[model samples]
Target: MISTAWGISFRAFDIGQLRIFFAFGVLQILNLIFISVFTLYQMLSVHTSLTLLALTPIFFMLLTTKIIMPRMAAFTRQNQEAVGLLTNRVTEAFTNIHVIQTNASERSFQRLIAQENDKVYATDMKVLMLRTLFFPLMSALTGLSQLVVLFYGGSLVVQNKISVGDILAFNIYLSYLAFPLTSIGIILSVYQRSKTALERLDPFFNETPESGSDAKILPFPNPNEVDIQDLHFTYPGSIHPVFMGLNLRIRKGEMLGVCGSVGSGKSTLFQILTRIYEPPVGTTYFEGKDVTTLDPITLRREIAYALQKVHLFSASIADNLSFGLIDRPSEEELARASRSAQILKEIESFPDKWDTQIGEKGLRLSGGQKQRLALARLFLRKPKILLLDDVLSAVDNITEARLIQEFRGIGCTMIINSHRGSVLE
Candidate 1:
């Protein structure tokens, strides 16, 4: 989704502009041929042999298309790939600058970027050399064709086969062909570059989006129970399994607390429940129906997953709280949600209150504040199942207790994972 929105979006606009330029190029070529054909007919009427002389440049054009064009296209593809890799490296570096600074690994990152930059530079030079060679090669071939025409047509004039006026007129017509012929090479180069870009973007455009069953799944008799049976899951491209024959069931309206040490699949369980990473069909169930058969859009509507690593947008507190709601939530509704999540007082303490602007990923807030903000957003949605993945870990004991009481009163089926036993109790 990020690649579709950011990387391919700008290139889509460039493709549109290329389409416009290519259309104009076609029109110019058609106009050149129309005028050239009339001029050729007049010269042919003067001397039948002169037709052969006018076509001498065709040999040069054929040479360029057959030999030079394929190589140019190959180099263009390499250049584009190199540039894309460099851009990704630069973006990753900036995104993790804080990590690099704290670890004192700036030099290592610089070396990595320099390696990618070197590759980009090499490919760019190859493309530049080809572009530089094209125009001059066309000019030399055109000049050579002109010389051939001058010599042959002058000889025809001396032999009284064609007059001096006829040779001059033929020479004038040939110059008109020069610009169009040279432009054809330039047009083809641009087309090849555009074609390569489209090829790279093809997978993203053709990728099957997250889809649900086209036919409606049968309604569950009990719509509140969450169950897992004989579950076995291994992440793609990894041999190690996260779950093997795991079985569990959470009854309706039950507040099930999950506790485990780090790297013991506590987080992975929540991910499977929320369908962030899909488990095998028939293994995971929600609303008493096979989850894989359910519409992810509708399924997710009733399931809210507040991640351990809270992600907050760089926006006002009210906007963050009201993030997923379809309707514009009233100020009163926002306050109520915040209060339920134990975050209302801190927000109200700010001079701007609900309108306070949180920096990127809530950089202006503490870890506890970010987690509470995410919970507040989830509470506003009023989902059927709440998957809180260590959301209270960062808060103080008093706050955690208050939030725990708040969760109990909500009366929803809750799957709470935590490192602290107090949260599970």
Candidate 2:
């Protein structure tokens, strides 16, 4: 049941105020620049007394960073990706709890999480090892520089070339070098993580938004009519084509059935028709207007596309049925739609009736009940066009029969797909 749409949750959380969090890193970088300059200038003046020896720590930090940053960044990125996969495993496991319990695959799922957790642990250990070592290594270099100063400067004082006061002042300056030098590792660590977080958020920023939200609003004079021309599509990363130069025209108020085997792009076709996955520009048209030029919000409102999988939010049955409409549907409207989907009888059987709670994705209901509930939601919309992808597959033959009988009363354009030819009939 996973989809490309899962990435949208990552997008929603990463936008808005989170964009400004990176600014703190910018200020930190500026501070780093100021200190590095002042510290180097004083140290260079001292380096004149003993050339190359006083410059040892500066060279050490640069050389160590060259060895460490790339490895640190690589480990950090792997850790991030591991965490995401672990999260996905957890989500999918929870969502598919019913199937897992039914098949007694609880241990299998437990093992799955254990395997993913180990991957995350392995990557985390690599990052921790680098972080733990980096600061100490920098501190050692700074101490080495101090030893160089004491040994060389003490001798100069004995020769009466430099005063004791001069040696003491130089040691005070070296103390300034110690704090900033240690902080560099920490500052660089934060900077590297910030950079990685930004890279992870690119999918959210790069998502293709509704292309025509600002375009001229086109009136759907005949909402039931649709024309698709030269439709060609290929999913990301697959070499084989799904569709190439396809064409179709369906009349207003026509009821049609589509028949195809598995992986035939049947579901994908409905997805494109609803503009869930946008079709290429000029390929899909509704009432003679290109779908790409019409606002997706308005287009989806007219075309009610139901996926094979049914998902219901945790809410009362009445609320789930009336989810998308501008105004709350009336009692009579709710009963009628529920009755049409052959679910009103079941709803009336409950003590709470319409007020009964359905848990996440309607886990409180049976598979057939959840499917009928989804169909009821679609019926409540009275959409101009209906795209059903095996929605009736879950219900028993008797319930399916009742729903099919009620379908004639809808009096709107519909496209249905089912493996069972009897449902199509």
lDDT of 2: 0.80
> Could you tell me the C-alpha RMSD of candidate 2 in Å?
4.2
What is the lDDT, from 0 to 100, of the residue 319 in candidate 2? 89
Candidate 2 local lDDT, 82-139, one digit each (tens): 7767777887888789899999999999999999899989998998899999989988
lDDT of 1 by residue, 1-425 (tens): 44422374336443653575578756766776787788677767776666666676767677777787788879877877777777778878877889999999999999999998999799889878887888778777777767877898888889988888887887787787777767766776777776776776676678765663354555433347889999999888889998899999998889998887778788899888767788888898875688877766667777888888898899999888888778979999998989998889899999999889998889899988898889898878887888899888889999999999988888889899998899999
Q: What are the clash counts of all predictions, listed in order?
A: 0, 0
- In TM-score terms, candidate 1 sits at 0.88
Tell me the spans in candidate 1 whose CA falls farther than 4 Å from its real position: 1-49, 212-223
Residue 52 Cα positional deviation in candidate 2, in Å, after optimal superposition: 8.3
All candidates: CA RMSD in angstroms? 3.2, 4.2
Q: What TM-score does each of the candidates earn?
A: 0.88, 0.81
Supply the TM-score for candidate 2: 0.81
Q: What is the lDDT of residue 221 in candidate 2?
A: 53
lDDT of each: 0.80, 0.80
